[model samples]
Target: MGKNILVLTGSPRQGGNSDMLADAFIKGARAGGHTVAKFATAAKKIGGCRACEACWSKNTACSIQDDFAELEPLLESAATLVLASPLYWFGVSSHLKAAIDKFYAYTRPGCKRPLKIKESLLLICGADEGLGVFTGAIETYKGIVDYMKWQDKGILAVPSVSAKGAIVHTEALKQAEKLGAEI
Candidate 1:
């Protein structure tokens, strides 16, 4: 049976490099018989986590309502979670960061809430090829996976691609598809 994959993409620019990579992965994952659902974080109205702990007291997932509320159910049902984002200042874009921060709500002590995702994949695109350009984003994802005890599926970091649709000429697109098929 195929797995349910939830993709959260963070790219303010539509058809940007990171979004292209996400599309490639989604195509491949779908071709491989996996069900894929993608949400464009940059286009959503999600906000930063308030840390009010109201979710714990109210028996809710998140207190500050926004697009993240819409994703809660999908997050719960997905078996594989894919985070695709464009590197900004050697870190993840704020669009994606906001949603990731809300994950803390689910980790409240004795919350009894557990993410259904068992595996995670990271896909990042950046313009600079500098050393450690992708370090922060990768580590952030790693921290989440480790804390959640989810398997780190893999990472695809495509550098030197700044312009939108630049990834169309690169082999990374094909490789991304292949990675999806493998999953």
Candidate 2:
């Protein structure tokens, strides 16, 4: 059986390069028979975690009362998590980071809820031209995967793609699609 995949995109621009890359991945994932849900963090009003330690205390995944509450169910049910974003200041966008911070709710001490995610994939693009430009973002992704104990499915970092439609000129889109399908 196919897995349930949750794709969180962190690009503020709706049809930007990273978003297009995510779209390709989603297309391939769906064609591979997996159920995929895409959440655009930049478009939502999700705030950073408050670290109140009251996770699930109010019978909710988080008590912040924002779009994260809507994402809680998807996070709980996902068998695979895909984080797609554009490199911002040598790291993932603040939008995606906010959602990631809320992941603490699941791991809070004494919390009963559990995340079903077993594997993860990463897709990142940037305006810079070298692989070194992705170091910080890759490190952050590695940290999350390690902490969650999730299998690393794959990572595709495309550089030198500053313009919105510039990714079309590169092979990253096809690579992302193939990775999604294979996953």
Candidate 3:
């Protein structure tokens, strides 16, 4: 079955370099005939996880109502998830990090029925080059995949892409299309 892919953009800058990378993935995924949707964190007021712990008693649903309530249905329907964010301080942008933390709403109390995410992907872009500038973000994403038991689809890290449209030379767009086609 074709997957329902959710691409969440975490960059604050409009049409920032990282978002361009995500657009590549979205275009590719759509071309492959999968259902895809993209959401920009900057445009939405997604707050931090409320830590109410009320989720357990109410079908893993949260009580500190906000935009998060809107995401539950999306999560339920998504078979593949892509977290796209620009590298900030060698970690995921604040918005995406908060989104991840909010995922606790999906956790089961008994730990018997593990959360399910099916398949997942991560797209990260940084302004500097280094062996592991993305290590922190990658580790965070891997941790989420582990919790959800999602398939390890792929992760692409692009370095030195600060200026908008700079990714055109990095082949990240082509790679994203391939990722979509494969998924």
lDDT per residue for candidate 1 within 1-183, as digits (tens), equals 999999999999988888888888999999999999998889999998987777756455787778888888888789999999999987789999998888887777756566788999999989987547898889988999999899998999988888888888778889888878888
Candidate 2 residue-wise lDDT at 21: 92
Identify the leading candidate in terms of lDDT.
2
For each candidate, what TM-score against the reference?
A: 0.94, 0.98, 0.90
Off by over 4 Å in 1: 56-59, 110-113
| lDDT, candidate 2, 1-183, per-residue tens | 889999999999999999999999998999899999999999999999887878887888787789998898899999999999999999989999999999998877766678989999999999998999899999989999999999999999999999889999999999999988999
Model 3 quality (TM-score)? 0.90
Alpha-carbon local distance difference test for all models: 0.87, 0.93, 0.79
Q: What local lDDT does model 1 show for residue 77?
A: 83
As for candidate 1, its clashing pairs are none
For lDDT, candidate 1 versus 2, the one ahead is 2
For model 3, residues 1-183, the per-residue Cα lDDT tens digits are 667888888999878877887888888888888888787776667788777666645454666666666666676677888998999998888887777777776674743223446899999899898737888888878888887788879999998888877888878888987987888
Worst 10 contiguous positions by lDDT, candidate 3? 108-117
